[model samples]
Target: MGYYTQAARDVWTLLIELQPQTGDSGGGISRDEYISQVARDIQSKLPEVFDLDVIRKKLGLEISPTSVVLLQELERFNKLTLRMIRSLAELQRALAGEVGMSSELDEVARALFNGQIPVIWRKLAPDTLKSLGNWMIHFKRRHEQYSSWVDEGEPCVMWLSGLHIPESYLTALVQATCRKNGWPLDHSTLYTQVTHYRSEDEVKERPGQGCFVSGLYLEGADWDIEKGCLVRSKPRVLVSQLPILKIIPIEARRLKLQNTLRTPVYTTSMRRNAMGVGLVFEADLFTTKHISHWVLQGVMYGGRAIDSFDRRILTVYMDEYLGDFIFDTFQPFHFFHSDSGGGISRDEYISQVARDIQSKLPEVFDLDVIHKKWGLEISPTSVYCYESWNALTNSPSG
Candidate 1:
């Protein structure tokens, strides 16, 4: 079947299985009762789809002990599914008036519907889901890439962003490099080199030294295709698509940092909660000027692709001067219809976001700090600000 056909079938099966039974359907069940029944069904059946026993057997083909990392990631996925089930049950109870709804539970439901990994599972910074349809595409592509790696063995060029646990893949690369060179694995670190090819399909074979990886994005900066170096971000362009890169293991001391920015790379665009886990590694990007220039511009790298709106928000957050007035005039979006009672006040919303941002980066400043740093806060108020924010946050992206 075609990709869309298969996806539609899958989603249709899920909806049919989870559909509510009304009085006309012979169950005579209320909405709350239907939700409770669906929750129980999810708890029972969803986990079977994520069973790792079968996956473990497939990965066991690689007899190397390094396979443990991949196994652990599979285990993590199973655990996350369990957590999702429990959260759903909580939501069902809240809907039945047995308990109160919470922000966390609401977030879990949103993540599930949008086909994005929940923050509780990934422990990464919370991000805009954009739209259900857009994220489903990313989710499907991720699974396709992962299944190809598992079924066909390692590929000549890998889509690095597709893995559930990218750190495991990087570790495997390091181990293979060390074994090939007869070097101590503990003494080596990852090193990245940009390739001339802009796409993964251009490379037909695996490299002798390291693996070729694709699917990385440059935030707050752009890559100069001709110069093959870091450059200022194009006006109104939020992110730059990076070319294929080769990652190899090298001696720690052998690594050079002179005239290079040790750019921290994340698995996603949201970097706040990704310090230890979601942060894959640091890649050195060649720069002509001082490193502070990149830092002030908030130049960074991420593995996954974000929609245009997310790119715009990242730019606004990074460079206050770009959209001070626009950002100041905006309002927070209310996602839940039944729960949007008066909604959160603008100041309260800012404080909540500041707390979240501060928890991730204690040393840096918060959103309010952006206004102070730029000394620019224009309020071109709009009557439709709230509606505009909601539309931007939830609209489907291409």
Candidate 2:
């Protein structure tokens, strides 16, 4: 076995029994504190022979000394495992020159390494993270412009939650890469399949081989988890395989977006089609008055997610979009209102108009625009006031 795990009962037992009982156990809390201090005192009584300074200078690890019997047993098993792997590789490589060597090598390699890695971290590339951040900055600024048609009333926030494994997290990463770097094939296509093939590891109704695999194999990318083969046996993809998907470069390079370097993995994900559906929400026949026509096209910018296993990466991107959506949603067109000819004051109305112009049309952010366009010759405090006022009952008509 590559790794060992204690049974649930054994683990629970360990959790309950932390410390051993000793003689002279009286005043419980005071006794416990004294015991901890005494333990520390005992620990501090290290022999002068093993100086930490010298140890650090000479040692790479804090290895404990072992008896002859245990040392021999450990060394014996380690050598046996090492020899087993070397022998397995040799067997596979010897069969390399034969036909279908990739398949054979895959079989042997799986029989060897799957036992080694029992836990998968499911880590993301550092470059992917950086690119995603940059893409978000760009998306938010662009969405603000998209929000031009809507009124800024509330925050556009969407609540999403889920777990992301290795295979499916690719979709959001690819979409961010595309939108920021500007790729083709439409936004939704980022989650769709580019190239796919069925290997022996798949568990499905139609166990098609190679490119002749079933529709699901071509549906989207997968992480090749430990649960493949319908028997809960081993991971699907082998280390030797070059994976499966290959990107069409001419089409990928068609757009030539600026600042492509910001998102390093954008092209890589596109090439390998590492992307897929991240998250989705649905309502039974939910209709909105704003949408006039529903045209079903190839791939839409914000249509629907085809592969939503969890809330994972969807919210990371959608948070910004939804934020802008909510900000723009439910806004009254005639929001900037005040009593005419001063029941309250002429100054308050001018300030209201100034704020309306500032938020509604941010292009006129300049103080000069405030002075010129709205004709509001007021203090700078008028530029950004969040408060709304009630029109006074009494009117002062000139």
Candidate 3:
């Protein structure tokens, strides 16, 4: 049968089997009452479906002859499902304001989803029920995690604004680098002691700045050919050092905006330069320069670098000017301006920039891929794609 037809049959079967009794309760079941009763029945039957033996043996656990859970419990006992569920549960509990952590429960969930628990637990062991109870508890926690991540939206701050490394590989890289450099590494210790440097001024003021630093200022370290190994630096260092992380490959794309449009001539910086005269003419006559500025800025921040002259112009525009003139002059075609002429608010702007970078940049930053290749889990969050923007924003050190 086709997927939709099969799905329809299954859903209809479930509704029929779990439908509310019609003999009592004001003669016939109201729609709302029927739905409520069906939900309650489903909840009651969940334990039977989650039975250990049934899951281990991969038996189809159906509520009725025609309907079964869409996904098999044992089949989803892998890393991706586990991580997704864990993230979901954690967020849910956090939003609920419940102190809902349980290490024992977590262990049982890991055993079940990771396929660590024995097959015999399905039938012979009393601990099987206990394991199921633990599974429920952990399942709740995972739900909380997922909910929290979703409500907050995209991660608090991506490592280098969506540099595409999974959290696991990033963590492992950090750990390995620390170990190599003889720097101490522990999640709790690092959490409390971390600091972020946004500019050279901060780095100068605090030269001993350790790992947890983030944002646009500090660059990563790289191998110095003359020094024979990786040596750390700033500004330029960030891009250079990325290759050493071995998370993702960085590639550069080049484009010329001037060729795309045609316009009249005006004045030129060099009186004899035709190209210069053409550009100046376009800028003066049609306000092309203003629109060009916004488009170029969008492209640059979106992770593509312009030519030398274009890059210089963009740097001046982004750094020298402090207001929304770039956005304003561009008007209706404000490519980078996300929030209309009222002006893109800070949060909105940041989110837009981050999303653009993430989408445009290559996925070389995934820590999980790095770890699987190198046998390490560098970042605590590396096993999954989700990151906590709240954690990053609330971090005192950053």
Candidate 4:
């Protein structure tokens, strides 16, 4: 007999023994009587580990595990008989090229040495695990041509996340490589796909055409254009078809202040500065009329009249204290009164302006060196104040 046929017969024998049996009071056991008897036996053994599903699958039976089966006077030995049947089936597969080391197989042998068989076996059913393991091993050893099937230009798509390389650099590199290889290059035909990373649970979709391509992903990092060095350890690649987005550089103005007063006094001043011309608001701030005016002055060097109280407070604090005294205490305080010509205390105004500025621009006022820089009369501050006031006055609605 063929090795496979012998294995199959062994498995079948084991299954037959596990089948439940029934007998009539008469000498001969009838099929219907046997089935009824087995059914009752199964019901009595309900909720036991001797599951019918496991038994059926092991025997390679066409019937469902839940289906009723008849056996003649052998119902009690079902579990033991089934196990024996499955073992013999496995032994047969092991002997044939269906399992184990076979000189005729190549792929199966490689798989066995590579430790993949154990992994597959662990996931398989108890009855099929051993045979499946041997089969895979045998197939690998006997099939040389089968192993190369994967190398036949099967399209492999890889998704990269956390890529930090710029799109331009990658596109340029690809273009350069194509030129060096004498490949026909189409710059206009470049296409890319992009997925924005938001959170761990968020799934990034594949990029479609017209998206940007940032860099060729190698290993876990984005490769540099010149030397192909990975810039970072994490595997991430940006795909964009458009020229890479350029980061706009911002120049921050630093001001130094000196405290000339024996007792530091609060000063207020209106700052009309156009500092945030190109910058967009990172977050929205809900300010009173006064605070809003100051914020606008800081951003556009102008005031919006939506909130007048906010504007008034901003104007008083910025012009008197922040722009003048706090910014440059060395310059003598020239104060004006509400009624017209009266000198106000530089110390009081400076303190008030400082407090106001702090409340409005908490981030800006949190600097340790601000006190030192505050006394330096810088051109930027002056320019900011001038622009703010001019913007306020020139407004048609103002």
Q: What TM-score would every model get versus the actual structure?
A: 0.53, 0.16, 0.15, 0.16
- Best-to-worst ranking by TM-score: 1, 2, 4, 3
Model 4 lDDT, full chain set: 0.32
> What digit string (tens of lDDT, one per residue) describes model 2 on residues 1-398?
11111244346445534433333345555433443343333234311221334323443463322112222322333343344344344444444433344554443333222211111111211112122224334323323422321233111210011111222223333444455456652523321211234342332222121111111211111223232211111254211221222221123334343211111122111112224332221111111211111111101113343222222244334343233343234443332223453465558778888998878863323444445765647555554431111122223541
Q: What lDDT tens digits, residue by residue, belong to model 1 across residues 58-168? A: 766655533565566556655655666678778877777788879886555544533445567455212333343454355456546545655676677877776666777
Task: Please provide, for model 3 over 310-397, each residue's C-alpha lDDT reduced to its tens digit, 9 standing for 90 to 100.
Answer: 4456555554443456544544432343344456776887888799998987533554455578565456664333355435545897
lDDT of each: 0.62, 0.29, 0.34, 0.32
In terms of lDDT, which candidate is stronger, 1 or 2?
A: 1
User: Model 4, 1-398: lDDT tens per residue?
Assistant: 12244467568656654544333424476543433343343334322224445444544654321122211101222343343334334433543447763342332222332323333233231122234335434323322211221233111122111111123223443444454445445532222222333222343332221222221212112323343222332333321121121111111122121221111001111211244222211211122223322232332223353233454466566565344333323344344433222355656767778999878862323333543565566578755865666676579975
- The candidate with the higher TM-score, 1 or 2, is 1
> How many clashes does each candidate structure show, in the order listed?
0, 7, 47, 73
| Model 4 CA RMSD to the hidden true structure, in angstroms | 30.6
lDDT of 3: 0.34
| Per-residue lDDT of 354 in model 4 | 90
Displacement of the residue 88 alpha carbon in candidate 1, Å: 7.3
As for candidate 1, its clashing pairs are: none
Q: Which candidate tops TM-score?
A: 1
